[model samples]
Target: MASGTSVSPNANRTRSGNTLLVWSLLVVAANLRPALTGVGPLLDRVQAELALTPAVAGLLTTLPLVAFAVVSPVVPRLAARWGPERLLGGALVVLAVGVAVRWVPAAIALFGGTVLIGAGIAVGNVLLPSLIKRDFPTRVGLLTSAYAAVMGGVAAVASGVAVPISRAVPGGWHTALGCWIVLALTAIVLWLPQLRTPRPRSEAVHTRRLPWGSALAWAVTAFMGLQSLGFYVVVTWLPQVFRDSGVTAGDAGWLLFLFQAVAVATGLVMPTMLRRARDQRAVAMLSSAVSLVGYLGLVAAPGWALLWSVVLGLGGGACLVLALAFLSLRAEDAIAAGALSAMAQSIGYLVAAAGPVAFGLLHTVSSGWQAPIMLMCVAAAGQVVVATVAGRGTVRPTRP
Candidate 1:
């Protein structure tokens, strides 16, 4: 995180003019998760009203990961063609349309709109890091952490309010889901000025490509995927796990809300911690260790659910922010950063996409939560192992 170390060519470009652009980036970050998380709180109402089978209902969560994997690789190329700011603006436009389209009371529109929303988010996911690298390279650590907090905080709010918005809006779950269009629109409006600012030209400088053949790169990729998988597993199953332990559905829901709330704090703090550390191994190990304790605690004593949730949230949130930082930290320039983001996220999301389904299947096969819960513990340990290898300060020499 030292600006003097591996300075991206544009690292010197950070200045006061970025204040509005920074806020705009945060606004866009705010919209990225609401469309995804809002659906989870309202899923039961949606499934019953739409007469959806359990299998189909699951796609409501999985579609975003699918879109992320399918669209992420293409996003950098698209950004290369149309400036990142313009592409981000266009993606927000698509997100707005997608969020609004869900208002159409039909199953096709529900799934289709989710796909569109996911696709837009996928593009934003890849481009945002590169955008940060170009516009705020010197402040990468702070800006990344801040926007990450914005994204998590908005997601928590959306999840908490989705059901209430449904009741208040008259259209029930449909309106609840559609209400997020306001967030998307807010992003689009803020992002408009960025579109007018020309994308910086760094195309002429050819940095080495992403070090894909390096073991460290694969380690980083595994760390990203495992952390994502652990998070999605908790999000999809934690409430049910609590209910099985005799907690009421309402309180179980509150646990989910609490989880996200704690996550917002870690999202804001982890990058700053990473920036100050010489090597990230200790932070990485500590995060996974916290998650490990939480997983084991949930299995052994779900009665203390709130306590375990806060621990899991802290660890999971830290892991995610650090994974994001790896993309920026590992690469030397904007193009390399984009390539690394695309590589890590594309593979990472696909690995994560399997979490919910696999957990559900494991529960069904065992007729108990024990097996799936233990698998999560294994994943938490794996995170520590991979982070150790990936968190090394120096990248390996590029393969010929």
Candidate 2:
């Protein structure tokens, strides 16, 4: 029997509506990463002003991921009740407040505001794939590639520009931190167009009871989380890691830039390559290999570590982009995409939140950098193991 998926009279209207929504989603997505990733370069300055110990500084980075991890599980349900349009918009508004709050003189307010931004970002991360799935069903790989590429490009720009912006502005760290509020405002502006009608599908999702009762689904979700855990650990602390290895700050920062910038290319290219390959295992393994080599090089040779960091960045960037692609690949349809997004990110980010804190605690306890280096090696090895599982050509056990 033919499926009930016929072109009814309202089909064209639905298509027109969703197309405009997708474009707006892309704009919002571009802003999200820059806000989260931009803070790393300025971590030291923030610490100096606040009289923060290294442990406390690490918490600044860790808290956001913890918020991300904590908020992720409820995002699909939130989207169901509130709609992605509503949640996405509200999150940005909260993000703007969070950004503004960080500029305040008080440290308590700064930490509270940072948590709010992190919680808000958690919503954006889960919502994007759902938006892509609903609007660009036929072109998910391409569009996913676009967002990943844009995300990496923004991070690289934010990293490379953080010092310059901090130097140029009188408020230094405050100004550098507030730079992202403009992007948040832009998202709210673009997203306003999506808020006109009631989100009918989301209402249905709210009413329906979906179970998180499958092993394979959990596996895929955990796979996404662990890989991200490793990636953020690197992005958050890699520059300082390089600096400690005797590399100059200027060169070390550029290597950080290279990782993020090169990922833009990988983000654009990896999905296309994955689509052509029968299984993503080879690519996943190759990415892990590069990541391992990059880290090993950094640990083994401090002076010439810049090149390896680039390689590491390239591999890490590819891994993240591919993880996004997996959300689409394993979902049965759009609704499943949203559900998978919530599942993957909720579990994934919690796992990822450990990166900075763990690194800091290990360094603090050992009173040496060797512990963190070994920990990174272990994380990179875990990445290989996770990718091997996630790259397998199969959907989650449950059907949409």
Candidate with the greatest lDDT versus the true structure: 1
Q: What tens digits encode model 1's per-residue C-alpha lDDT throughout 137-244?
A: 787788888888888888888777776677788888888888888888888887786666555355432333445676777777888889888876776677778877
Give the poorly placed runs of model 1, Cα more than 4 Å off: 1-16, 199-210, 394-400
- Residue 54, candidate 2: Cα error in Å is 1.7
lDDT of each: 0.78, 0.73
Error of 2 at 357 (Å): 0.6
Q: Model 2 over residues 147-211: C-alpha lDDT tens digits?
A: 88777788788877777788898888777877788888888898897776466452245321232
After aligning candidate 2 to the native by TM-score, how far in Å is the CA of 116 from where it should be? 1.2
Per-candidate clash tally = 0, 2
Residue-level lDDT for 312 in candidate 1: 93
Q: Candidate 1: minimum summed lDDT over ten consecutive residues — where? A: 1-10
